[model samples]
Target: MKVFVFLTLLACGAFAQQGPQCKAPNGGGLQPVLEEFVALIPTDKVLELVLTAMTSDPETQAVMEFLSSSEFYQVVDLVQSQPAFKSLLEFACSDLYLDAAYYFNILAGIFGFPEVHNQTRAAARTAGFRGLLLDILELIPVDELKALLDQKLKSDYYLQVAFQKINSDEFGSIIEALQGDAAYNNMKNRLRGLGVDVDLIIDTISKIFKP
Candidate 1:
């Protein structure tokens, strides 16, 4: 009986040294449990709440402090060194995130897609084309925008369409009108008024129309 008790104690000590297993048959780790809890939340409301918090002084300050911390830099370095982190970084920097609110608003409109006078569209249109263009340009990085345009312009279909349009009678008439002495002079005057060098404008347009 004494020998049996000693062996049992030794086995228990070995088990403790090996570490006790976390045996939750239903839930696994803290991450999985937190993810499950978050899944229950209305994400739209949560997003709006988070945005509101970030805009507040306290929350922004807290975020700035954490971002400037050595701990945050260590985490960033670790994440960047991981191979899988590139994919996540790409996703985070993608158009999906840049236009997340736009996509969500579109999704919201789908419920009432058949209905007229969508407030969202109306509000956007009311902001005016130039204002909207500026807002969109502000959101996109200059290099990414340039690369996207270059790729699109390089496509066979896009080049074909552009060639066809430029060869059309309407395009011919537009070029003729723009190239006329009176029209060209008026254009130069207008450009000069807008602080552009008339000589520079003429030189640029001349190169564009040159064979």
Candidate 2:
């Protein structure tokens, strides 16, 4: 796993050297780099490696160490300092928030236990919080994101807290102001026009807000 992560980092470094403008459509895009990385290793092997590490305390500690190390920060700084990264970040920020909260669910699953959460948060602090976050904002497809989020939220306390916050009076007021009764009625009408059962949307929201 360490070898795999090291090689992956090396490959990313080499790829980033190509500068941001080489790929037109994505603008030095992450897709080709990710594809190349994926092609270099079999999925089964990768999964095996991940599972092995997850089962071994020493291996997990090694990973945690690497994550919080100065070397990792250097990599993060290099990535963030790149013009391509900045460009991609601007583009990502424009639409990223639509799905960004889903990642909290992912994190919550990984660090849901207080012991794990404290350890991970401490590591993140050592690694520099902003740098750690900016380094991992790559997007997944919406459907896949939703699926992962759904699975993670099943055992995620942080996600529950986040959802509760969204349902709280402060956030509710914001939501209400943004889409009050008239707007919701209009949305229901629009959905009905598109042959969608508006009740389904309402029911979903009702479940989300249920005490």
Candidate 3:
């Protein structure tokens, strides 16, 4: 009996030394909580809340803080895995995020998406920043996005920058990863199909998205 007990103890010790099986730290186990937080806010209300938090909250000076935070993005990715969550993000952002694309600058630290920063823009290019605002361009208004695009068309510098971002340029491969989710997945084109006039905005994006 004593020998058996000793052997059991040794086995337990070995297992402990092997360490707890790592779960890959997906969202640090906080995706559900973040999903809940997003669910509570209505689609139209999301922008309002972000704007409010940005304007009123001392801890977070801007919605861009939440949008670009890698931690926050992690949470968003996990929640986005759920169809319901993805649906909400897509619908809400269509009316809000795209319209508010000019505010991306405040979140660039979190939005750089370096993984595909060096990659070339895909043919359809339906993904990777379609409607998703970059950290640099998110801060400006639609009007500015248009003006910048206009300036770049004339100079050529802005066009290259936009190309780089679409093809492969950032660390997180943010452009690529964003394509996996709602903002860049398919909605931008849908909006255009709905007659949103995105090209007009792209023309301006060149000027404002300044590298």
Per lDDT, the best of the predicted structures is 2
- Per-residue lDDT of 27-103 in model 3, one digit per residue for the tens? 22112222232344343533544444445444334334444566556554453354443332232123111111112
RMSD (Å) of each candidate, 1 decimal: 29.4, 22.3, 22.3
Write down the TM-score of every candidate.
0.23, 0.26, 0.23
- Give the runs in model 3 whose Cα sits over 4 Å from its true position: 1-172, 180-183
lDDT of 2 at 7: 21
The residue pairs that clash in candidate 1, if any, are none
lDDT: worst 10-residue window of model 1: 113-122
Root-mean-square deviation of candidate 2: 22.3
| Pairs of residues at least 3 apart in sequence or in different chains that clash in candidate 2 | none
Residues 62-136 of candidate 1 have per-residue lDDT tens digits of 543554465544444443344332332222123112111222223223322111111111112212222322332
TM-score attained by model 2: 0.26
lDDT of each: 0.32, 0.34, 0.33
In model 3, the worst 10-residue window by lDDT is 116-125
User: How well does candidate 3 score on lDDT at residue 47?
Assistant: 54
Better candidate number, 1 or 2, judged by lDDT: 2
- Model 1, runs deviating above 4 Å: 1-144, 154-159, 167-170, 181-184, 198-211
